[model samples]
Target chain A: SQQGEEDPQALSIQEGENATMNCSYKTSINNLQWYRQNSGRGLVHLILIRSNEREKHSGRLRVTLDTSKKSSSLLITASRAADTASYFCATDARETSYDKVIFGPGTSLSVIP
Target chain B: DARVTQTPRHKVTEMGQEVTMRCQPILGHNTVFWYRQTMMQGLELLAYFRNRAPLDDSGMPKDRFSAEMPDATLATLKIQPSEPRDSAVYFCASGLVRTGRTEAFFGQGTRLTVV
Candidate 1:
């Protein structure tokens, strides 16, 4: 079974609106990272949030992690059409080896222009 | 400018044939991972290596699939007598084993179709 699962498998929003995607995991983790994938291409790293950190921001992207709940959320502010893609959450679980990272199914987001 | 590079962006082969995919991770990154993606199984970790040593490979089929990091920069995944069910996109990612936080950089992936 996968360690991480993202909610609302698919989402759609206006270009200027805010988009939020949530991910839940079943284990203790050292850090969680978010990635975006365009159609027919590989994934691109978005941001990484350590377990000790509660919230992190990079430009219009914001990520929040709650270790107690084993859940994390990614928020994209003022969404643009370019932001339309599949978003995935990956975690480096404490139970796994140091270099291994497990991935979630992902959420497909469509931003309307 | 540092990026993971994968060879033969696409491949198509017949069943019972052998297929191999290669990845060249970014220099200075000591950890490499292999992943398979399909419509049903999302992104699945097949194997991974740290410091050119195989740390884990339980996710891969021992009979047909094998992964190896022959050198610091190159990683290979080979499938012998491939089956139709083996068709999927394979990705390679590399990252550092840091103290608290580590970031994974992914390659463009190699799409394989076993006919």
Candidate 2:
């Protein structure tokens, strides 16, 4: 069973705009990581936010975690055509002794130039 | 420069034929995961290994699917008497679990087709 679920199944925006994707999980998590997948390519790790931390930023990507709500959000500032891809959130549940990462369905973002 | 490696970027097999997919996790990484992705079901976790020990494989179908890690570096997922429904992109990912927090690095994935 999938632990995380991404909202806004699909989104479209023009270049220079911002795109936001949200993910919600059922169980408590040790950390939540975001990944991006291009067409026909494997997923690439973007950023990881630990449960203790509330927010983190890397480059133009900003991630916010709200454990109380069991959710996390990924924000891309000044989106470009290259930013078009599927974004997924994976949760490392704290219920397990070992790290077991489960991925969500993902939110497809399309950036039009 | 280190990355997970998967063999046979593409495979085409007949129904009922046994198929095996191989993955070489990155050196020094102890966790390995196998996932199958299709348009309908999206990404489904098949199995995972931690420290070369089978951790959880309940997500996989026990009848035809089997996953194993012979050593720390190599992991394999095999399907006997493959069916058409089993055709999907299989991905192998490896990550180091440090203090219970780590991000995965994925291979290109094997595009399997069972006709």
Candidate 3:
């Protein structure tokens, strides 16, 4: 079983609109990270939020984590066509050793111009 | 600007044949990971090595799957007598493990097909 699971397996939106994707996990985690992948390419690290942090931001990307709910959300403001890609949430669980990260199925986002 | 490199971006082979994939981790990175991605299974971690030592391989099928890092710069994943179900994209990632923080850099991936 995967530690993290993203919602709305697929999403589509127009440029200039905001996109929000949610992720839920099954266990306690030390941190959660978000990654973006273009088709036929490797994943790009987007952001990371530690267990003690509630929110983080980087440019147009914002991530929020709620430990009590074991959930996190990624928000992209003013979407652009270049933002079209698959977004995955990876969790570093509290019990996991070696800092092993488990990935989720991912949400496919298509931003229209 | 260093990146993880994977060779043979694409591979096609028949069932029962052996397939091998290689990865070159980013310079100075100490941890390497091998993962397989399919439409159904998504990304599954097969094995990982830390500081050139095998740390975990519990997700790998011990019967036909093998992974090793012969040195600090190179890692390999091999499957003998490949099965149809083994057709998927294999990804190699490398990262530096530190207290309270870590980030993995992924390779372009190798797309393998078994006929």
Q: lDDT of each structure? A: 0.94, 0.94, 0.94
**Candidate 2 structure quality by residue, lDDT tens digits, B1-115:** 9999999899999999999999999999989999999988888889989898889998899999999999988999999989999999999999998986978999999999999
TM-score of chain A of each: 0.97, 0.99, 0.98
Per-candidate TM equals 0.98, 0.98, 0.98
Mark the 10 consecutive residues where model 2 chain B has the least summed lDDT.
B95-104
Q: Tens-digit lDDT track for model 2 on A1-113? A: 78999999999999999999999999999999999999899999999999999999999999999999999999999999999999999998898887888999999999999
Alpha carbon lDDT of residue B15, candidate 3?
A: 97
Q: What does the lDDT read for residue A49 in candidate 1?
A: 91
The alpha-carbon RMSD values of the candidates against the true structure, listed in the order shown, are 0.8, 0.8, 0.8
User: Where is model 3 more than 4 Å wrong at Cα?
Assistant: none
DockQ for all models: 0.85, 0.81, 0.80
Worst lDDT run of 10 residues, candidate 1 chain B, spans B95-104
For model 2, the interface Cα RMSD in angstroms equals: 0.8
Candidate 2 overall lDDT versus native: 0.94
TM-score of 3: 0.98
